[model samples]
Target: MIYSPPRQANFFMIFSHGNGCDIGTMDTFMKILSDELNTHILIFEYPSYGLCQGSVDINKTTVNNHAERAYSFVHETLHWPTDKILMYGHSIGTGPACHIASTKPIGGLILQSPYTSIQNVITGLIGFPGYLFGNSYWNNLETMKYINCPTLFIHGERDGLIPSEHSKTLYNSLGHIENKQIILLPDDDHNSISYTMSSSCVKSFLKQFFPPSNQLLPEINIDPEFRVPPETIQTSSSIFSYNPFTSLFNLSTVSINATQSVYNSMFSNQYNNQ
Candidate 1:
């Protein structure tokens, strides 16, 4: 569902979804944003969600895989710097978005209706430790600690799945990469946060976070006519195939199943080569 415009621009809007959600659920927001920003938006899927399958014990949708894959695609294939991208997360999307901002050189990041951790929320709800629960997804708190980009945190005050306090916890953790802002709506719930997403203030948000420069195009001032959703996007082809940034670091050829030992070595090599 991520629409790629023909010519590559410096700025890319990357959307990461929650556990069971697919890029389809996020298309409306991205299209609206594209029309406003006059550019393309790439929304990614979590494993076992939407078109993505072949389950990994750890959710492919987790911060570890999703963040690094997209980051590699942009830096290696597109041959762009982190300064040319914006990381956007919603609900569970908050995990990868925050992780990318911490590891990638991004212009900014956005988190909507985010949670501190699923484990934390479950413990609060069930009066038991989250780690004691069979599936513990309450680890995003640790990732939020490293975010270094300008960030926008938007949470519905009346959310059911997660509370605005989660966003507050994250805002307090960031040390002002450029600017960090949080918006709370009076009667909004987790899903209803999308309604406020279409608000006119998005123009200002884009202006501030993903600024318009001769460097990157601004969102088109007009809204887009809702288009029929496509069945799939071809992701195998490289979009940034010609860039030399990737050549210098040699990071893309690594395997999908490598252990942390193999993966950490690449970063170490990159550090030594630099």
Candidate 2:
């Protein structure tokens, strides 16, 4: 495990890396997240990946066991609050992250290049039926229904290996979450998202829970190419909607005053692509 400490961290982020990436390759990305959010981070190597012992275990059961162990190391052993810990998963790491979130209480979740399920990704990639892999990561779609925390979805539009559609599907499934955001980078591919994209939008999502002090950073202008999708904000009578064709982040004219029936219809129509 690698720990990067900040003077006054809002929370400790438990980060999971994608396939073929261990803690070493993720060092630079860890530094970037830490610097952007002013938070401590813990990144660990998977079994048999990098310098770890034994064989690689990508099965959902084994992966969930590993995630529980890490959670215990920090929350049980070190005595961190369950509500203050955030789980972040990239690519295959989303499997374990979603598993832990379904079983544990967490402040938030961040899924980068997430998929509805590995089987769905496989089906999309090779045109094979998902049922052929019956015992596979069966139901992230089902697990997501139980996770109601604030969430963020990040993906690259040009990701050839796992298309951005995966993230869109995952985002649409987050019906229980009151606050959520999605960012689609136009120019970035699977591997380049970490370095090519700006962390400003990520920090924006984190700040609602961890408010900054007097020392505020100046707002950085985001490049027009990186498209940040509409975020959902809860209100007394209705939910705020995202307008894709707008200049500002939150446009009032597109505000959706949804009754229960209208909300369902609006949400279904807005995310119909999934």
Candidate 3:
């Protein structure tokens, strides 16, 4: 799925979503992100997630392949220059985002609720080394050595699912990169960071690197039907409500029932133990 602003965008972001939500659930958040940053965003749907049809595979290789295809679509089909593309990933998506940023030439990178490696996450959770059972999947700490672009890592200091130390470790790993930053939200958790502080952080980060073009463009008048009702927009203290905007876009036709179950299994240690 793609979201473009009314004016020509200076940079484009290839977004990889986290577990438990598909493109359908992410529609409102992405729209708000596109509007706030005034940049085009292309969300890559993993296999068997959203409307994409294929066997589900969440390993680093499969997810990285999907991310590469999304990158090619933007570079080849959309004609966006490689230097103007930004990679944004959340949660499990950070694996592919790091892979792409390390191997490809991108403007910048944004990682939310990231982990050093899948093994590290399990080790932290179960008090056992994750590598003892199998190979390390999505070893971002190793991948960070190759990333030279400006990067931002966001995490909730109160995150219970993936501790804040994961982002801290990743931030410390990028010592060679001058334009790197990490933001820890005091009031946020693993899932609340997106709805609470992400927009402001993203906007500030873009201004530092990819400022908009000097030429002025006419203001865009959002159609009434597409404009989210003011009452529906929640304050920082309230939970975000997606019910109002759920029917506005047809791009999320795929059912999320199966996707949710798959995500739960992937994250559960019980499945890993088997």
Candidate 4:
């Protein structure tokens, strides 16, 4: 489990990641979110992923079981209040998030680069009918109806693999959920949303529940190596107008010097190579 202690924490988060990623891949991302929101975060490794020993089955039952175990550890073992817990799922992680929230009480839920269902994702990719197999693996679109707490959806506008439409449809499907917001990052793809703009969107979404008492803290530095190239700036499935560059510099807590230093390092390496 990964955790970040806050000066004055209002909530704790249980974070689940996507397929092929373990806690190691999410270390920095989780830390960034924890620092920005000033909350303790618990990142659980799926069965067979990372050091957790279990079958590598990515089915509904196993994933839900993992979510249950993690929640129990935080709620039963750690004794955190039920209402003070938040669930965050990214990509395939949305499966367990929806599974747990469908039956449990949580302060809120955050799904990043989510899918309607794993079956839907497969159909969208291969053009094959998912119903042919009669599987309902990770049916978040259906499970969402049972969630009454605040919900936040973050997706990449240029996400081709799962498409932003999946998240849009999921949002629309949550008919009576008044406290829900969908944010689509224009310049990012499925894999880049967290580093690009997840923090800003999360901070805004969390404000209604956990109002900021302290000034925005300095941001954790993102790896400079993953900068988006200019050539890939294509339009995505965004219904809202967005400018990524402005968002990057206008962050509530990110330092101008740090941003500049990242750019300087990138440019210096390029110049030296030339």
The C-alpha TM-scores of every prediction are: 0.70, 0.73, 0.76, 0.74
Q: Write the per-residue lDDT of candidate 1 for residues 71-153, one digit (tens) a residue.
A: 77666665655676777777767777777777677877878777777667654443344564444343566876677777788
C-alpha lDDT of all candidate models, in order:
0.60, 0.66, 0.74, 0.71
Cα lDDT tens digits, model 4, 53-86, are 4435445676688789989977777677787789
Q: In model 1, how large is the Cα lDDT of residue 147? A: 73
Give lDDT: candidate 2, residue 158.
96
- The CA lDDT at 45 in model 2 is 53
**Cα distance off (Å), candidate 1, residue 234:** 18
Residue 102, candidate 2: C-alpha displacement in angstroms: 1.0
RMSD of each: 14.2, 16.5, 10.2, 16.4
Top candidate, metric TM-score: 3
Residue 212 lDDT in candidate 1: 55
Per-model clash counts, in order, read: 10, 0, 0, 0
Q: What range of 10 consecutive residues in model 2 has the weakest lDDT sum?
A: 234-243
Model 3 TM: 0.76
Which of the predicted structures, 1 or 2, would earn the higher lDDT when compared with the native?
2
Question: Any residue pairs clashing in model 4, and if so which?
Answer: none
Query: How do all the candidates rank in terms of lDDT, highest first?
Result: 3, 4, 2, 1
**lDDT value, candidate 1, whole model:** 0.60
Deviating ranges (above 4 Å) for candidate 2: 55-58, 196-198, 209-274
